[model samples]
Target: MSLAVALEVTPLPLRHPLPTPPPHHVGQPPTAFHNPWPSFHQHSWLDALLTSRRNRDFKPVPPRDQLVKIVRPEWGNGQDGLKATWIGHASFLIETPKQNNNEGGGRGVRILFDPVFSDRTSPVSWAGPKRYTPTPCTLAEVPEVDVVVISHDHYDHMDAETLQPLYERRKGKINFLVPLGNAVRLHGMGIAMEDVTQLDWWEGVQVTVPTAGSVKLTCTPSQHFSGRALWDRMSTLWSSWVLECVNTSTTATAPGPASPLRLFFSGDTGYRYVPSEATEDTVPVCPAFGEIGEEYRPFDLSLLPIGLYSPRHFMSPVHCTPEDAVCLHRDLRSKRSIGMHYGTVRGGISQYFEDVTEPPRRFREACETAGMVWGKELALLNVAETVVVRLDLPRLADLDLEHVRSSKHTKYFGIILDLFDASLKKTLERLRLNTNSFSATLCPSLSLLAQMRKSSAK
Candidate 1:
């Protein structure tokens, strides 16, 4: 009988229901595009930050081990979980830390963030730009998920190809945590709204799944517009999320388990410096910076954008540069951040759209120049990258610089360079040897982009 008692002893904490946030207004969708050239407005700060055509290529930095299943245990069952894999362009398959069965805290579930899996972030594949490199991980390889957090309805962040398929396979079983006005679109795609939990800024739901354990998903504010088409911009809400699972002692000081473990997935956004003027009565504005800024909290893990930002005048207002991404980390007050949405893809859809195609090394340098700790502040991760941050410590300016600088992103700009060269070569071949008109007109734009890519590579 004593042996049996000893064998039954455990340290797994009792996980309880999450404490919900106060009620918030779920405002109507942003239904129109008033910023005629949002990119120009966004790029106003990229004077020295912009990468030139002289450098464009980047090295790939796949994680030492691509599997998070192996890394979660080190994060431990106490207050940490396994690390996660970041598929490029804002899609992540985060592995929650190990959980104790029936306790409501250890449920280690798979999650998808702003899943835009399609080749193009456009309504029609024909017009939008294609992904320069293949997604770090494909939709099929991912497993049945516990949650899907869609920040907004932008084509790049909330793609049809990605969402429709995930919904088809995991809709009923998966809890979809999305923003307001997005339910109409999700339902339009055949998902039941009941299965979907939509929220405005500062709102959240605590999910306790039999297999996945207990987790709290919270919607936070971002300073960017939303839309799948021109007419529908802002009609749908956009947001970032904080997914956390806390409390584990088998027993602790408090009656319930503690909830502090967190992962932040920033959907798609420019930096928060300019403060988006919400003309449409958007909910979720930061009270600290906006009308209600005091209520915001810093994120733990930030999945920030870092690509498609060329022609600064056009892309600034809509996309963040690598340097700007560093600033966002400071803005969000994240503990440890991972960089995305920069080099793996090309972006900037129109006067309205934005993307960051530049590498973050230079941006990191720029941030450091401005007194922000570069390697210590944020970690710029690449396709197929993973990191395990021990939740036990508070690290700000002392991260592994060697680890960060050593991490390399895939070089997608080679294709751009090759394409640019190929087109120029092809055009030259078709033209007469003495002809200058066609050659003169085409070379400048191609040359500038080429040089810019080249400079950025260095």
Candidate 2:
């Protein structure tokens, strides 16, 4: 299907405009943008350089043998449960659970986030922050995608080398969702304006996939600056995103009523700023996260950044430490979270101080301290690893009595009876009930017992 014909976009109106104008439009000419919160602080270049030089002794890259294991993705025609594949760094491919299509077949919607597959994250590829770890899979290995979401214009998160070819390969069949001021860049990549949807924070758009069901993508706030070049720092907007499955099919053959899935992507954000001379608790944190949690709490899954936060005084304003990531997980009320934006690349100079493997270790420890289980509640997945969660299951109420009475479904009914018998035994044991006495009381009528015995014999 044509890109325009395959995707339908509907703008979601906000209840009210933000109290303060979005940071990207704070100035009249809008030459630059700024973090709106008062607690955000940006250090001078000289201080950052001096700190980087002082902390050069630590290992910034792991040995080849210690690198994350890469696995080939198995998408299964996108008809499975909700699946997310980590493509290294901040890139992820998220597929919703199977939903019925117009052709009477089942398919799932696929969304790609901030794909950067270039060797170097820089304006020019020859000299910059080269990837210490390689992409889990090549661009060609990635399955067909329906939507591409860009968080910002930062080199590490957004690479022209990746986006251009990705757009071309899809033949502009992909709908691109990006923060405000980013459409111009996609246009330069040969993407048509109609295929791109730019949204400000709090604004959302419902996208209808021609083959699959619909999803809602919302541009949410992030405490970070954006720029690919020195002169144009913060000229574009940066944001996190909330993706929600809206309309899944509820056919009679489906497992049960459609249960929507909600996912949060913390593109790159700081939970709270930490200064060299001050402790973290004394400083104020960006209130956007708390507000986000209140607005969209209880996410089924969340992808949170958890690395490149060394030289805390400088990096804490933009990057989240592993501990900070744990805090964000709680604030967002996520059921499960996976760490990202770490272990993939190290900058030439800027983010070279932190030990390469420290993020996941710290993340585990922090989750433990917060009374959360490591793999159960929050985790750091191996690169290219795929995680799947089933969102719909058959409930007791969903069982059709008439269908169960039919001869074709008698075997299923028998299985259900076996399950009920096992459960009743467990419940009786837990309650310390006398099985014989309970059975006698339950069937007190002798006539009913005789009738049941006669029916069984017959």
Question: Evaluated with TM-score, which candidate comes out highest?
Answer: 2
For model 2, what is the alpha-carbon lDDT of residue 417? 15
Off by over 4 Å in 2: 1-5, 28-31, 76-79, 101-104, 251-259, 348-351, 393-458
- State every prediction's TM-score relative to the real structure: 0.63, 0.81
Clash-forming residue pairs, model 2 = none
**Candidate 2 Cα deviation (angstroms), residue 226:** 0.7
The reply for model 1, stretches above 4 Å from the true place, is 1-82, 103-107, 250-256, 272-298, 349-357, 370-376, 392-458
lDDT of each: 0.51, 0.71
Local accuracy of candidate 2 as per-residue lDDT tens digits, 1-458? 33334567899877326756555475764556677776578766687668878856666465777766665555433335667778899999988766664442356678999999999999897988888888867898887788899999888888889888888877646789998889998898788888899988899988777776678889998889887766777888899999887744665555544646678999988766678634765566676765676577557688999988877877888988877786676566566788999888887344556788788888888777654556656777677766665543433221111101224322111112122334323432332222123221121122332233234333
Per residue, candidate 1 scores C-alpha lDDT tens digits across 223-307 of 5667665466456666667676643434343334443556667676654233333321121212211211112333446677766
